[model samples]
Target: MFTQFVQQFGVTTCGTMVWGWHGRTLSSGVHHPQYGDCWLRLLAAPKAKAGGKLWDGPRLAAERFDGRVHKAQMYASVPHVLDDFAYLAELSRAITEPVCSEEPVLREEPALPDRWWASLQTDLDTVAHGTSDRVAVRQEWINRVVPQFLNVEPPQIRHWAVAHGDLHPANLTAGTPYLLDWEGFGLAPVGYDQALLTAYSCLVPGFVKKVRDIFPVLQNEDGRAALLVVIADLLQSASRGDHPELAPALHELARTAI
Candidate 1:
């Protein structure tokens, strides 16, 4: 199926998904004369599990944010034998360099424009209030993850907004600074994205300081609460043996925040 799909796009060679989690992705130099390069993602539609919805975030972002987001050029869907569905979305290749390398452990900060930050805040607000149906980031979810992973009670949330739920260095591009991976994008605690980026930058002291200096949210109470939530989420991922190297750092960070 994968090979056939590539053929439809006339792509001769396609690399494996650079970061495959909830879906599969591939990067390829397009064979078509009209297009140069592209990225493709195949995602499984939401199931009948706890949080099920038909909203396609990447598609929505492509439409709403347009030039600011990685462009979604084309997409198609296929029905599964069961009561589920799958989709293939092709996006325009990012022209700018990513803020950090694919493995963000040793990445250095990239120069970004002030306008990028301004646009990010505006876009996040638009998405959070945009007409879409998805699960809101409830206090219960944070409460559950915090105690289970960080072994501490959850903090109170003072604000909420639409966030790029998986905000980290790896998912951001510099120069122009376009955010990637909208699969997890949704309404979340205010400053959640900033907190997540700070958590991931714990290894790089300079970068951490830069992030803190740029985003004033890090100094406020609500921002601190959001950081605690991000730490708990990271700790939970660490417990599953994901990003083991960052576990200790995340633990210490969580301690300081708590």
Candidate 2:
């Protein structure tokens, strides 16, 4: 199916295969006769589960945003039904730089330069301050989950800002930084991205402090609310065996924040 998929693009794979969660998506680098290099991602899911706002995120991002930061440029996307499943194939300009980390949690502190940090601070601010009616996290969902996950009523989100939705270490590039995986980008609580990055970096206290210093909003009511929301979400994921190693640290952070 992938060979057939690439045949439509007139390209050939050049790099190692990368798989998304549960092998639902497959991504790799491709070399084109005219386009040189590009990224190809194919998402396979049941027909009923494939078409939605999140499914269209990369295309929407390409149409709506550019120059806000370094990111992939979508050249083409084709969605079609294959047997009982729906497949969405997206072709984008390849990012030559490696990601900061291969997974959400960083095993060690990243030795990034001042400009890299500056770019992240500036880019996140730019995106968060933009106006968007789309949503990354809903109030009703937060209200329902926070109590179950953290045993506390959700904080009223006083500030709602556009966000990347998922901004863990793996989604960001090293050296020259670029944000990846736009599938969850939309309106979320103010400082949601910063809070998420900090929450996932619980093992690295020094890096967490640096993030706190860079974004002083983490100390404000709105940022605190966002942090609580992110921690609650992480706790929920921990319960489900996702990043179970962070469970203890997350509980400790929850105590500090609460």
lDDT of 2 at 139: 92
Runs of candidate 2 with Cα error greater than 4 angstroms are none
The TM-score, computed over Cα atoms with residue i paired to residue i, of candidate 2 is: 0.96
lDDT of 1 by residue, 1-258 (tens): 455556666655545444365444434434443565566444444444312332466665555556544423443322222356444545455344545557545456656677776766565555556544444467998979988878888897877777777778777666446677666666778788888988887887777777788778778887888889988887777778777778788888777677
Q: Please, what's the RMSD in Å of model 1?
A: 4.0
Worst 10 residues of 2 by lDDT: 61-70
Output the lDDT of residue 37, model 1.
Answer: 53
- Give all candidates' CA lDDT scores: 0.65, 0.87
Clashes within 3 Å, all models in order: 0, 0
Candidate 1 segments exceeding 4 Å error: 7-19, 44-55, 68-87, 91-99, 104-131
Residue 51, model 2: Cα distance from true site in angstroms = 1.2
Reference-based lDDT, residue 58, model 1 = 61
Tens-digit lDDT track of model 2 for 1-258? 677779999999999989988898998999878878999999888998987767888887777666666678888899889889999999998988888788998778888888998999988988887776678998998998889888887888877988988999999999678989898889999989999999999899988888898899888888888988999899889889899899788878777677
